[model samples]
Target: MTAIRLFGLAALLSLSSMASATSFVGTTDMIGRALISTTDGISDLSSSLKDDKIVLAARDDAASFVASQGEIRGARLHAALQHIRTQAPQLNASDLQLAEAILAL
Candidate 1:
């Protein structure tokens, strides 16, 4: 009985973690999409990112733009972002850092 309770607790924790993570990701995606949608803002952002190490951060924002401009296009852009992130952990870290900086801006 005690073992069963522990298993349930662990499952609950895992689900909670997943929900929290998803919420964070969704929020980030929304913000990124917003910035990328603004043409002048995107140009400014690109300039700001020039000296920044995570230069590829703009790609995600670009993908967000593509997604919003058209449904099918957005789906493909989303897939591309997922693929790039998953396939290149090291490269993704720099990009993530650049994204964090952009968010701060």
Candidate 2:
């Protein structure tokens, strides 16, 4: 009986952790979509990102990446994106897809 109880508890804990992880992923997707949609000619991504909590979190993550590597521009930004893709594949995949929707200008 104790073994069965322990098994059930372990299953519940695993499921809860999975749920929380997906919640953050969903937030990432939302933030990415917002960024893609809001960015336009002569406008900055930071303006759109500032209003949302999830985007703020993502920005902080990106800032940390930039701080460690020194300066985020051109190739550096690309490197950061690639790092994010490897570190959090699900979230970065969504971000990349949304980024593709926006024009560079």
Candidate 3:
């Protein structure tokens, strides 16, 4: 009986964690889509993110932006985005998408 209870607890714990992770991913996707829909598609996101260091520099603000559902725009994020653009400027995507991309980075 105890073994059975433990098994059930383990399953429940695993399921809860999976659900939490799924929600996290959903939040990111939702934010990205909303930003894309709201913005005019004139700007382009990063051409390609080869340097992890650049992305890492703005990871905190990116996370905050995602957590806030984009309510929180960080100064660091703008700085990083400009840096990214200067490094690679040929693609096509909106600033919002680029912000989302920076979060993904």
Best by TM-score: 3
The sequence of per-residue lDDT tens digits that candidate 2 reaches over residues 16-96 is 999999999999999997766544411344343335344333444455444555343344345545544454443423433
Which ten residues in a row are the worst by lDDT in model 2?
A: 96-105
Error of 2 at 60 (Å): 29
Candidates 1 and 3: which is better by TM-score? 3
Off by over 4 Å in 2: 41-105
Predicted model with the maximum lDDT: 3
User: Between 1 and 2, whose lDDT is larger?
Assistant: 1
What are the per-residue Cα lDDT tens digits for candidate 1 across 12-96?
A: 9999999999999999999887656554443455465555434354455644454454332334334444554554433423333
What clash pairs does model 1 have? 67-74
For residue 91, model 2's alpha carbon misses the true position, in angstroms, by: 26
Sliding window of 10 residues with minimal summed lDDT for model 3:
38-47
Q: Once all C-alphas are superposed, what RMSD does model 3 give against the true structure?
A: 12.4
N/CA/C clash count, model 2:
0
The candidate, 1 or 3, that scores higher on lDDT is 3
Give per-residue lDDT, candidate 2, residue 46: 32
